[model samples]
Target: MEKRFISLIRFRVAKAQYLNMGLKFKKLLISFFSVFIILASFGLGNYFGKSQCKVCPPEEIDFSLFWEAYHNLQEKFVDKEKLDIQKMIYGAISGMVKSLEDPYTVFLKPEESKRFIEDVTGTFEGVGMEIGIRKGQLQVIAPLEGTPAQRVGLRAGDKILEINGTSTVDMIVEEAVNLIRGPKDTEVTLTILREGWEKPKEFKIVRDIVEVPSLKWEVKRPASGYPDIAYIKLYQFSEKASFDFSKAAIEIMESPCKKIILDLRNNPGGYLEVAQDISGWFLERGEIVVIEDFGGKKEQKIYKAQGPSQFLDYPIVILINAGSASGSEILAGALRDNRGILLIGEKSFGKGSVQELEKLKEGSSLKITVARWLTPKGELIADKGLEPDIEVEMTEEDYEAGRDPQLDKAIEVIKNL
Candidate 1:
């Protein structure tokens, strides 16, 4: 009996020893796997880190200060819930672009980018006027015809001192646009300072869906018994401008109009391609229209007229004013340089920089001024505007009296040609 009891105890002890050995083996396997996983993760992290570094340009900029500022904001900002990382990133990018001090070069967030598309598409909800920066002040480039702005007496060259009481001092064009535009039926107020105003005046304008016209034409018969003039008023170079201009060209060709009066007054330019396309009707094939100067950093681009040359020999006179800018300026420059067409009106607005819109992540965009526009004769149009062959000024009295002396002068000029 004693021997049987001792065998049982020995067997139990042996079982216990085998269980302990099994636990130790299991622990060893887990330890090995854990170490392997950590090593693999480290290897993958290093590989990815090096690959990312390879894609970036050589690091000449010290970004430690930027990171420090970012971290400080994240950690210590007053309202933690208001901390939007994406907005912070966008603000930083905007600041970087603003450092260039070029108002045309700007950063647009997703909403702002969408608004820009709306503008180029020739439709939007806003007070229908184009505003731009001139001499560091927000100036009215043009008030679209039949819109609230123009109907409310907003005129080209009027300085905008405030939008809804927000001072426009140091305000960028895009920022002012945002403040001025809103849902249809909303009202926006503008504090304007005209050239002759002793004090700034406020104009309250209601916003609406603005459908901008590209161009309008009429056959005008001068009382002086001159040839019928095809009076073409180009409003903007929006998306539909090329198509509209083409239609107008066809109509003018079919009509009995022999002289052309291209009225670009209050036209705040649009697409470069549209300008080039419009120039084709007036300039001979392969004639240089406008030159894109790249500040000697790259090869300059010369835009030549792709001619239908329909009006190449026709008597053409161009009208320009302070509101005529960018694409309008390009067209005016082309006509004067290529064909010696007479420009009659006030000097142009002189916004001659070329901006290229680059799409970034998250539907944002960066509009950077890639180059400055040069007339075909190599005259810079950036700061120094195009001088008219005959300078004509329209006074407030002329406007209030429903007298268009500029148009009358243009008619007179085209009559002799």
Candidate 2:
């Protein structure tokens, strides 16, 4: 997987849907894949004709075109290279998915799909960074902490100009990742254009077996000056998120603090169910956590507080940024709409779409954006992001001065509350 191939794909797509494939991947794979299976295979049933329930034929559709193309490609391919029929079958399935023109709607072939499952669950080898489309350019969301990209000075907001000699303008995150990630000890060169640097810097990053710790917590101590304040940051939404977040909430509750800040910056949502469950801990029973509108019907679910929602009574504030998305947006949106909690930071990442993944036969799958998510007040957050109650953009001067304007504003709001 050369970085150069990723660059060519990136510039071609113009804009792409984001996410990944890996084995640190498995647990995350099963987490989301289970949801997809639950959504797809668990459906009641569908049929073309009337509700005629009868043991019918084995069901046959026209595959004449496929057979024709299969033979033509095998016999007429110009290079006379050997072709694997199995891989070709996978390619046809991949072609079906790509034909949709929806980047999020992807078809992962066997090996890459397997690698995807492994990479996300825990870790594997790669350049060590998260990539996404921001404003139609392939951008690094954030480099994995202590990984090759991070160690090489890759930062959030850095534009990926090229991988090797290929360009990356419109590539989707998935394909780009597949191109960038490889076995350990591989050398991948990245051309980066950052905000402050005048020239696009180049870095030769060595791939390694990267381990991603899903949960990491630090005590925002009374010893550090804010005896009454606690900060909890959740990086990603995974299968165990509900439990992980619950533990964090309990810690806040047991602490001698009157104020708490849940750090959702850089959190790109995961399990919708987990997000709903986590939101449940912040509000009383019967409160609407989120709503979904697929145009066919308005589907909404209300979550009830069961665990330690006792912290809900405290003067609580939420921290969000351009990195907060999906489940993050859902949690933030629920609190702001139902409890009137102040959201402090810049605008949210606004990935307000519900994705439905369909598993095709032969170890490949299709991930498609099925519906757009809405706030409790029916606010849509797809291309347009969630605006904060108090808009505060981070400034380089503020960074140099070692001051957090957003945190200051958040504390001010909490104090007033």
Highest TM-score scorer: 1
Give the per-residue lDDT digits (tens) of candidate 2, residues 121-151: 6556887776777667787765655578777
Candidate 1 ranges beyond 4 A from true positions: 1-50, 53-58, 67-87
RMSD of each: 10.2, 23.9
- Per-candidate Cα lDDT values, in order, are 0.91, 0.73
> What is the TM-score of candidate 1?
0.82
Clash totals in order: 0, 30
| Error in Å for residue 89 of model 2 | 6.6
TM-score of each: 0.82, 0.71
* Candidate 1, lDDT over the whole model: 0.91
TM-score of 2: 0.71
For model 1, give the 10-residue run with minimal summed lDDT. Answer: 52-61
Encode model 1's per-residue lDDT on 1-417: one tens digit a residue.
Answer: 899999999999999989999999999999999999999999999778879783564458888988898899888999999998887888899989989989899999998898888777555789888899987899999998778998899999999999999999978898899999998999998999999889999999999888778989999999866689999999999888999999999999999999999999999888899999999999989999899999999999999999899888889999999999989999999999887899998999999898889988889999999999999999999978899999989998999999988889999988998
Name the weakest run of 10 consecutive residues (lDDT summed) in model 2.
Answer: 14-23
